[model samples]
Target: MEESIPTCTAFAGHKKIAAGPVVEVAGKVKRYQDKNPDAQILIFDDSSSQQVELDLRGTVADVLSRIPGNQDPDQEKSGPGRPRLGVVSREIGLLPRHWDWLALQPGGASVTLRKLVEEARKQNRSKDAMRQSQNAAYKFMSAMAGDLPHFEEATRAFFAKNRSLFETLTAGWPKDIRDHALKVGELAFHDDKSANP
Candidate 1:
């Protein structure tokens, strides 16, 4: 198993029930279901902070054991050269001038294109992550706090990167909800200048 196996955090209304591996979180939701029959239990991916629905019923272990991105069972074993990189070959249509420009680059068209893509991805990563985080927060908030006071203001503050404003707006919310909202917001708005702890 991968050490960094992603976690999914489970929430019900204003309360957070679990945060851990998918299986464990699913189990927690199952337990929580009994006592809070009317509650809406939601699971959010920790990295994306986006809501994910789990099929937690019968044979869950069997289902989870087949999580995607695991090695393909029927595929032939690897003969190594740079460890595969999960590369896949595909055809792309490009204008003549585009190909001409790429052909002049240092490594060959494929390598040049790959490097360009990686550079663009690196440049946009923080922005992309922030957008995903905001979207995730918005989805959760819409479901859980649509009726709460300052909802719109809080959302505006969230995307505006005004933490104090966001905090003030959510101050009257239930503690669980407020804290979770803040948590999701933080996940979305990581500062590029800050070092990872």
Candidate 2:
């Protein structure tokens, strides 16, 4: 008797276990998982019979950001929308000052966390540092588009469609992700509105 793992089934989410161009599938699911937790995705290639499993833990925005060519997923042919995923970062609270120090860092991501923390802690709270910290915080803040009309629109749609779910799921957002999640809501509002109206 021979047992077989289901070929086109995605576990723990709606993502189907199928295959396509590995890179594209990876890119798609990367964004898919970033936006939802209970949502699953499906990617299948009939030729090679490859499959992928994606558990969206957050908005697909982060994945879109990393895709190089297309930074704006909202403008693309975003296929059927699935429940957004929830992504959790293990890092500690990062204030504006921390962000400033990180900005000055050449390659903070690759550096050892201990070393990075030590360097950040070593910087004194002088007037110069304070000014620099303010600048850095502003830089990080600028990364998010508050006035983008699209942002407001997408959030409105999501709010109208998934009011209860969004509230319950978003309520548990960790300290580090609260602001980002809010921004995602803003973008989603823009997207949803554009789609329907």
Best lDDT among the predictions, by candidate number:
1
Model 2 Cα lDDT, one tens digit per residue, 1-197:
24333222222232233233444555556654545544545443222223343433345544434543344556544333331222223556768886677767766642445575557655532433333323332332223223333434434434464435544544443333334333323323333223221
The TM-score measured for candidate 2 stands at 0.18
lDDT of 1 by residue, 1-197 (tens): 23488787888867889888887777678767756778888888866667777765545454455444443655645554333565666678999999999999898998998898989977777677676667767877887788999999888888777888888998999887777767766756566553122
Model 1 misplaced stretches (Cα beyond 4 Å): 1-4, 34-39, 59-63, 69-85, 88-96, 103-110, 187-197
| Runs off by more than 4 Å, candidate 2 | 1-20, 53-197
> Which candidate achieves the best TM-score against the true structure?
1
Give me the overall lDDT of model 1: 0.74
Model 1 clash pairs? none
| Per-model TM values vs. the true structure | 0.69, 0.18
> Candidate 2 — worst ten consecutive residues by lDDT sum?
6-15
lDDT of model number 2: 0.39
Task: At residue 155, give the lDDT of candidate 2.
Answer: 42
